[model samples]
Target: MSNLVRSELLKIRTTSTWWWLAIGAFLSIAMAFPLNAWLFNTAVEGNAEDVGLTGDAASAPAQAANLYTSGQYLGLMFVMLIGILMVTNEFFHQTATTTFLATPRRTAVIVSKLIAASLLGFVFWLVTTVIDLGAGAIFLTLNDHGTLLGEWEVQRALLLNLMAYAIWTVLGVGIGTLITNQLGAVITASVLYLIGTQVVSVLFFMLSSWLDSLAVLKWQVLWPAVASQVMITPGENEMLPAWWVGVLVLIGYALVSGIIGVLLTRRRDIS
Candidate 1:
């Protein structure tokens, strides 16, 4: 298993895909951090209502937590793409047959890919977290809010953000398994993740309004992307489920994806 994972990692490291995704993630963080900081500042500086933030939602701890976890929206998509590529590449390069024949244990190979993808996700999370913390600290200090690291809310957000990254990557692997065509998988996942989430959110909002129930809004977390956001949301929110609920929703999706991936791969005719 260790050897198989190492082999997979080596494949990733040898390719340009990983670095290109990493660069995209970095640029995403670079653009998002300042914007998030500015929005947080705007909300706190007597215009909280303008941004729909009030009371606890507009507090230093909550805003700082959101700021510190910046770039997660797009970063997770990139991480998921990495996962998709990990599996699709095998089929794309016509290496799936070779890989399965060499190992003979399809389950082991799948597990190894899962591990490798998770590690890549962790690396992405680490890089973005470091960048967020550095910039967050500076921005907070200049704005007189401090780092807010001492607060449990901020810490929890960061921890959950890591979980989000790992889970999304695994989900990506599942997506790849389901869609073997590399280009199709990438385009589908990217569109569904980036655009689908927005469309879904809007639909949910319309539904909630039509039904005139705030409870309907909570259902939005069922979407993986929204779950990721909810999981890292600090403090209490009436319109969303608890942070732990978001974690469970995401875990449930990842588990379903993994099980399906393994079952499909075990029976798949690579030849």
Candidate 2:
């Protein structure tokens, strides 16, 4: 058992893409800085009088932080792909047989890889959040607004954001395990994220609405959309199942993928 874990951990630590993910996370925060500042200073505060708005000025800092974090979230999609490639690439390379031969335990390997991926995901998430939140505070302070980083809602959002990113990382690892081929896993995740999750679903939903002449059954085509919305908003609108439901769905996807991958690996001939 220890050997299996050791081997899996070694593989994860050595994977080149892991470092790239960290770098990308930092880069995402760096790029988002200016945009966050612009939005906080110009739109939220500047446009207030013209738009006849009246809200707490502190909300601008919070909103700026959210926008900054959003950029990091997008970059995490690539990190997920990186994880998938590392986890699934082993099979296509025929290295799993070597790994199993060394450890002779299947489940231990999956557990180790899952743990490592989750840990890496968590570190990236936290670092990105701090970068986004800290930079946002600085930007807001520079504009004559004092720091507002310790708000309850911001902390909650950061926690939820970390969990969301961790779930996606685990899901990506499972997809990698299930597919085996690195390229297949990457293509599948990319499609599910870029096309299936957002563009295709929204377009399909819109088309459905148009065909029904504004009387369409909206709930029928809301899986991906609801899933995304729930993850971001959690219990805000009760629009879909709570964020916990999405978390469960993520776990289910990862578990099923890992199980199937393990079964296949165990049964296949190793020549």
Candidate 3:
């Protein structure tokens, strides 16, 4: 275990990409807090979300939670790219073979990378949460929407958001394993999250009620909004899964990817 962890840390330390990814996550959350507060101050207060949804419609805490979290991750795009690179570089850079020859426990390598990435994700998530929340609070005070802070919902959101990002790092590792090429994995993930998925989701929102079987969280809408909406609202129905539902769906993909990556690393001629 120590050997595998040492190998993973060495690999990450030798690269500049990891630092940049962490920085990107930091900046995204930092900017998002102030921006969200301004948007809510201007837009939500101006009939933005329709009655019963904003201003006096719902709990101020809920509205504040939604505003701070909605776009809290503009940097996550780059963060995912860096994560893909970390896993796939072994295949591209001709190191996986040598490492396996020395260690022989192939699965250990993947697990080590998964653990490292998860910790890295957690650190960034904590920093991002602090700054983002602080900024929201300061801006809210300036704008005269101050509160004395609420109860467990904020704590729940912070914890869940960290778990979500950590899971995403695992998912990115899986993508790197399956593709075995950093650029391909990053681009494919980006397309799914940034473009293709969102487009389909918007269309679903327009047609959900009419479709009879369609719900806002159908495949189209569900994952696309998962990153933004997971902690922003409480579960609506007892039948509905918790906020981590979509994230759990994502973990299945990560497990598959990681297992296949171990197999490929063991068998493939990693030149």
lDDT of each: 0.90, 0.62, 0.64
Query: Which digits, one per residue and each the tens of the lDDT, describe model 1 over residues 179-233?
Result: 9999999999999988999999899999989999988999999998888888887
Tens digits of per-residue lDDT, candidate 3, 66-174, equal 5545334555465456567877787778777787788777788778878877776676677776666777677767778774256455556666667666766766777
List candidate 1 stretches off by more than 4 Å: none
TM-score of each: 0.97, 0.77, 0.81
Q: Considering TM-score, where higher is better, how would the candidates rank from best to worst?
A: 1, 3, 2
Which pairs of residues have clashing backbones in candidate 1? none
Worst window of 10 by summed lDDT in candidate 2: 232-241
Error of 3 at 268 (Å): 2.5
lDDT of 3 at 246: 56
2 against 3, candidate with superior lDDT = 3
Candidate 2 lDDT over residue span 1-271, tens digit each: 5555566657767767667767776776677666656655655655755443234333564454455465554555766775686577677777877777776666666677677767767877877776776676666677766665566545655676777677667767777867767777788777777666666556656876677543333332234323433444423221234555555555566677667766765675656
Using TM-score, give the best candidate's number.
1
Candidate 2 wrong stretches, greater than 4 Å:
1-3, 46-65, 68-70, 207-229, 238-245
Over all chains combined, what TM-score does candidate 2 have?
Answer: 0.77
